[model samples]
Target chain A: MATFHFELVSPEKLLFSGEVDAVVAPGAEGVFTVLKDHAPVMTVLKPGVVEIDAAGNKEKLFVRGGFADVGLGGFTILAEYAIPVAELDAAKLDADIKNASEDVADAKGDEARRIAAEKLAQLQELKTALAL
Target chain B: MPSLKDLRNRISSVKATQKITKAMQMVAAAKLRRAQAAAEAARPYAERIEKVLANLAGGVSTGAPVLLSGNGRDETHLLVVATAERGLCGAFNSSIVRLAREHIQRLQGQGKTVKILCVGKKGYDQLRRNYEKNIIELVELRGVRQIGFDQGDAIGRKVIDLFERGEFDVATLFFSRFKSVIQQFPTALQLIPAQISANENEAAAGGALATYEYEPGQDEILATLLPRNISVQIFRALLENAASEQGARMSAMDNATRNAGDMIKKQTTLYNRSRQAIITKELIEIISGAEAL
Candidate 1:
């Protein structure tokens, strides 16, 4: 398998930068994967997991609210919040889902309600995917 | 002319002050190390985002987002002044405020209405004396132990909401840029209608020059990215300000400690001289009384 450079960046610091075989990211439209020599593309990211396969080892990280860009420089993900799945706390996830549900119920405007609902859905989806 | 008791008190007070200043200097030095590391770590993300923005901005020539292109009016100005929450940092807060003052004066001179958005308690305290009416909001981070992206995001959201409401025609952010431990530069960056550096565009374009396919569309990506860019810029400013604050405080406390030491030494010398003079006078008196007897 061919490899390309991949970088995962957060506001506080750069999390990961290395040559990777494949990166599967959750895009706003849908989930997509990037491989070596992939065409240049830019997409917004939602709350979900980012799976990285590098040199036969696999890593999964949860990201929320950011963008992914694949260019001549390779692939880069600017995540608003990112943490390894292994380090995630199940109790915190449940609390977040509960809060998000309340926000959805209390939202007044149509746009606000829609955004809150979307957030709730994403959190629920993540909970099921992680099975925690 | 003073008593030995007074001299002793003065010397002791000076020595106590020196101890405090020395402790502060050490604390500042330790904090500066961590702050500098954080500022350096955040650089790559900022640079990468800028590059990505440059690429996207260069591709879109017409129908650009309102954030990339202004509202076509420059009558009103919003200044976002960011300063350290605490004082005792030599001239760090004052310099930023001074720069902001000059900007306000210049804008008012142009027959333009100016609004102030102060980010720290120090800045708000200084600016409110004269421009109290002009200040729209004061965002205090006094309770925060460390600056994070969420703080910046909150400020950015407020600015965007104001812009959307037609509160100001232009928005500028003021902060102290950390060059080194000994040097910090006060800088002003235009936030609304984002300023994309010319060199960045050339550098980004030089690399790929390949057209990018936007997932949804160019407009949608830009609409989201530009807003995020604002938050990123604010986060960078806050981090730089943190490093600069620690640097300034360290140097200031170092000077204070040295001055206190000098004062203590002078007071000790005065005390010794006074005590010796008193002893010599008493011995002379006793000798004179013996001769008379």
Candidate 2:
């Protein structure tokens, strides 16, 4: 299998940087997979799992509120927040869900309420997806 | 002449201060390592974003987002000053505040309305003396053990909200750029109407001939990216400031420890001399008393 450089970076630190066979990222539009020699594209990312395949060793990371830029250099994910799926804290997720629900209740206008409700849904989806 | 006890007490006090300074220096050194690593780790993301932004900005000349294209008037200016939450990092906070002060003075001189947004406790405290009325908000990261993306995002969101509300036409972020352990350069970055250097655009253009296919259209991507870019820039600045703070503190504490050592040496020398003089005087008195007897 051909490999390409894949880097997952958060504001705090670079989570992963190495050669990977493929990267499956959740784009704002939808989930997409990138392979070697992928076209240069820029897309925003939503809160979802990013799966990486390197020599049949698969790894998953959770990312939120960031973007990915695929250039000639490599495929890079600049995530606002990223953590290994194995290391996701259940307590923090629960707290976030609770706060998001409250935000939905407290939101004033239709636009704000819709955004909050969407965030709440996303968190809930993430929770169930992770089965936590 | 001072008594022996007084000299001993003074020497002991100096020694205690020296111990404290030494401990602080060591702690700062350890923290500096972690901070430096964090700052280094964030550089790749910042650099990549800059490159991508430059490319995106190059492609879109007209109808660029307000973040890339100005709101058309520079009547109001916003200064976001980021400093250390705690003082004692030698001139770190003051230097940043000084840069901000100069900026405010310049902007005010231009007959522009200037508003301040302080991101740290020390900056707010220092600028509050004169610019109290101009300070719109203070975001204090007091108890945060480590500066994170969330803190930067909060500040970025606030700035964006203010921009959306037409609070300020121009925004500049003031922070200390960490150069080395002993060198930190106070820098001001214009956030609003984001500045992309010409050379960067040229370089990005020259390097990649491949036309990027922006998902969900170019304007949509720019709208999302420009805002995220603000947050990323603020995040980088915060990380740099954190490293600079630790570096400044390490060097300052090192100097303090050295100064305290010098003081302890001088005090010990004076203390010994005083003790010797006192003992010698007593011996002479006893000898004279014996001779008189």
The alpha-carbon lDDT assigned to residue B180 of candidate 1 equals 81
lDDT of 1 by residue, A1-132 (tens): 999999999999899999999999999899999999999999989889999999989999988768999988799999988889888888878877897899899876898799789989998998998899
Model 2 chain A: ten consecutive residues of lowest lDDT: A64-73
Report the C-alpha lDDT of model 2 over B63-124, residue by residue, as the tens digit: 88898898999999999999998888999999999999998898889899999999999999
**Largest DockQ belongs to which candidate?**
1
Off by over 4 Å in 2: A99-119, B198-200, B207-210
**lDDT tens per residue, model 1, B30-88:** 99999999899899899988988888887778999889899999999999999999999
The DockQ assigned to candidate 2 is 0.74
Model 2 vs. true fold: TM: 0.93
